[model samples]
Target: MINAYATLASLVAFAQDRLKNEEKGATAVEYGLMVGLIAVVIIGVVATLGGQLAELFASVSEELPAVTTTTTTGG
Candidate 1:
């Protein structure tokens, strides 16, 4: 029973040491942060341009002439 407890303890300690030395999770977190920043920038750009585009289309529509139609029948 004592030997078994010692082995378990050693294994636990080894696992803790490995976890402390690992960098894979940190890199993934960095990548996630970069992607988040890119998304924020994209949202900002769209918000800035959306109003300008709407105004441009509104002006163009105002400049265009209105359409009218007349129908005539001959007997």
Candidate 2:
């Protein structure tokens, strides 16, 4: 009976250690998935808005005045 109990305890301990390691790996995988999803969302938004944003900047630039600069040399 005592030997059986010892064997069971060792098995439980081994399983716990393995589960801890697996949890770490699972957490890393979850973070990677989240980053991938965020990247996809950013790409989609940029694709959807790129043309409209370019037109907006072009219109703004057309409305702005050009600047002239003069440089003087000092002795």
Candidate 3:
């Protein structure tokens, strides 16, 4: 029982040391989280404005008059 307890204590200490020393994976995870947050913000802005923009363009197009052109040939 004593040996088992000692092994568990060492294992816990080793895990704590490893966690404190590790940085490479943490940086990659942080970068991924930042990118995900930016993407969510962009999607939200676009979704909110998309309908308004489409309506504005539709109104503008309705206000514009169409133009027709004819060509004449000289003999």
Candidate 4:
């Protein structure tokens, strides 16, 4: 019917207006992109330095002294 068509058209127009006026959705998308970029940079840095960092830790561990534990009983 013609009435049904009119109702559908009005609904579509309302949806279009809401989409145009909305800003929160766009801001959330931008923040998500920034976080993804930061994660990628962190992963790249860790991958590049992983081997050197491991070697540095190994050298430091060699320079440290061993631990000795003693237990005493008292009555």
Candidate 5:
């Protein structure tokens, strides 16, 4: 029973050591951060462009001439 306990403990310790010494999870974390940064930048660009485009379209709408009517008399 004592030998079995020691073996189990050793296996657990080995697993913990491997997990602690590993760099495998760091790459995934780095990639996630990069993706988040890119999303923020995209959102900022869209907000700026959307505001400018709305202003431009509003100006264009105002410049369009309204319909008119005229009458002429012949003698």
Candidate 6:
């Protein structure tokens, strides 16, 4: 009836007010945005350094097998 409608309207209004008064979710949202931005920057830096890093690791890997074989034979 009318009372039920009134109660629902009041509940909706209360929920709207509570949402407007909320600050906890806003902080988490800001942190999420900051993390997303940082991730994008990291992705950009890694992308830029990708080729150089690959070559460096390749050279290390190539030398590592040789070093390991020499050490094993020497022992």
TM-scores of all predicted structures: 0.38, 0.48, 0.42, 0.50, 0.36, 0.64
lDDT of all predictions: 0.61, 0.62, 0.61, 0.61, 0.60, 0.70
- Which candidate would rank higher by TM-score, 1 or 6? 6
TM-score-sorted candidate list, best first: 6, 4, 2, 3, 1, 5
Instruction: Estimate, for each residue in 1-75, the C-alpha lDDT of model 4 and write its tens digit.
Output: 355456546655655675789733435654565566567667767898999999999987776543212222221
**Residues 1-75 of candidate 2: C-alpha lDDT, one tens digit per residue:** 355456546655655685788554335654565566567667767888999999999987776543212222221
- TM-score for candidate 2, please give it: 0.48
Off by over 4 Å in 3: 1-26, 60-75
Over 4 Å off, model 1 = 1-26, 56-75
Clash total of candidate 6: 0
Please provide, for model 6 over 1-75, each residue's C-alpha lDDT reduced to its tens digit, 9 standing for 90 to 100: 355456546655655675789634445654565566567667767998999999999999999999999999999
lDDT of 3 at 42: 71
Error of 6 at 7 (Å): 46
* Steric clash pairs (candidate 3): none
Model 6 score (lDDT): 0.70
Count backbone clashes in candidate 5.
0
TM-score result, candidate 4: 0.50
In model 2, residue pairs whose N, Cα or C atoms come closer than 3 Å (at least 3 residues apart or on different chains), thus clashing, are none
Put down candidate 3 lDDT per residue, 10-53, tens digits, no spaces.
Answer: 65565567568974334565556556656766776789899999
lDDT of prediction 4 = 0.61
Cα miss at 35, model 1 (Å)?
Answer: 0.5
Query: Lowest-lDDT window of 10 residues in candidate 5?
Result: 66-75
Query: What is residue 28's positional error in candidate 4, in angstroms?
Result: 1.1
